[model samples]
Target: MYRFSFFVALISYSTAINAQQIELRLHGCQTKSDKTYFCQLSNLGPIAIPAIEYNVTLAEDGRTFPWAEHRSGQEIAGGLEPGETMDLAIQLPTLPLRANEENVSISVELLPQYLPPPRPPADAPATAKTFANQVEACFNRSTLSSAAANGAIDVNVTGLKIQKVKNYVTDDAAAEQLFQAARRAILVCMSRNGTADVDVSLRFDGSGVHGLPSDY
Candidate 1:
């Protein structure tokens, strides 16, 4: 009966996750070369997961740009490992001229799909248990890190806004760890930029949770 109960719980949890939504955020753009548009793709919320892939494309009107090459999918294997986020940067090919003065309709889709489980109650045991385990989980993940492993790309749009997304963390230690790394990167980039402060809001979502919860 114990094994049966555990099996039942596993099935129930998997089903709930399969219905969850994958959140893809277009933080904004950075011009790398004279003609390349380096777009920032962020897997926002529930938590990052490994083996997840994304396809991004840019279009003008109903037609796609031939010059725009869809780069290879970025994989966040090793998962977000709870209270962790990965930032990826992709530089898309740009035409000699801007396609449209109006905002270009850019689309990003997560392959293999994602469904976030419904939010658990504030007092749920899983929430309480996972809270304390996040940092340790991240540490374990440090071993799985690829030399190429980098978090979602930070976006800096000239004269517009700075959409600064805070790293997800369950505690101060985890938060500080992420902050120090980010600060170092920003300092390096600041030497080439005009300014760093751009007003933006905090938008939270499941990084790429799979499936929805039964309750929600």
Candidate 2:
């Protein structure tokens, strides 16, 4: 009886872990002359995702221009399977001649195909501060000493706003590495805390990370 109980407990734990593991990667994005941008998304997790919702923003000098948003499940025939990739194309309004590639930013949100089992009441509630702390800690632990030696990386949290820093390091590869590391840490922390959405900003000052609240 004791052996059977232990086996069942282990299986349950494993299932929970698998259910919470979801990873989606944005391979690349490019703009076309027709005011449309195309991007490739890949499912890097064990589970399949039903669909994706994404927002594309065009901004310059802290001003945002009108842009189109898309939300659809029909893009994926059945679902996005593990190691599978799908293409996304979004149309935008005509932009001012001054608008350039640097003004474009894309944010993506994945929709799970199935809901995971409910968490027990004992589970701690998710908070933005906690999430930010987790991200900072994870990034620090994952980054190399040489890469982080010259610049300081800080993560701060407010209501729902999150800030990330860049432009301090001269090494493009190292900067990208830090950005990816912070992104992965945020994803994991959000998953554990059941955080649905967050607003992320990138700052060029090279100071540190900060968070604020969003209307969403």
Candidate 3:
């Protein structure tokens, strides 16, 4: 009975130790050939994680912020052996315009290439990932695209116009989610009046921060 109890305790300890032995760290690096930027994903864990083939998910409250966009909900990494890391050459997603600021975090899971990627709904278009970057860029560019508490959010684009409204409730939560999901503006508001609609106009410029022209 003494030997059996010791064995059980050992097994439990092993399970707990291996629960999340995979460690991930993000470092900003540039490639030598083209000088383009990439977020380096390092695996400083006991086990090897497949590179580019692994599954990655961002925690909204996580402190590590990545600048790349996940066209699909997840990305596939190549392989990362213990202490090995790989760089993802994609641009990061942008945070939405909001009254309150929050943090972002990331998590990755290993996926061997032998398995197939997840399939979208049958009715979904193939080009869904293409707009992901555009959506993120738009999120930061629009001030009026988000709401303001205790006052009106007046945003005027260079060539675009803006309209004013009174006393809009400024909830940053929903807009932040919308920025992660789409390329347009989503208003989260509260009001004293019964009116529920306000017209907002904004544009996503590809020449702003992170969207700068190559010639320059």
TM-score of 1: 0.31
Model 3, span 49-105: residue lDDT tens: 432333333334433554332432123355567677665654323434431222433
Which scores higher on TM-score, 1 or 3? 1
Query: Per-model C-alpha lDDT, please?
Result: 0.35, 0.44, 0.30
Q: Residue 103 error for model 2, in Å?
A: 5.0
Tens-digit per-residue lDDT, 1-216, candidate 2: 000000000100122123245567664666565465566777777766654444444434455543434443334568788899888665544545655545544433333232222221222234433444545543443354333333333333233544443233333554456555555666666666666364433221122333322221
Better of 1 and 3 by lDDT: 1
lDDT of candidate 3? 0.30
Candidate 2 residue spans exceeding 4 A from truth = 1-19, 64-75, 93-216
**Superposed model 3: Cα runs more than 4 Å off:** 1-20, 29-37, 51-78, 94-216
Clashes of each: 33, 1, 18
Question: What TM-score would every model get versus the actual structure?
Answer: 0.31, 0.36, 0.25
User: Per-residue lDDT for 1-216 in model 1, tens only?
Assistant: 000000000101123113333354444455444334444445554544453444455555556443244545544556554344455554444543645524454444444432222343344244223322331222222322221122211222222333333333322343344444433433443344433442212111222111112122
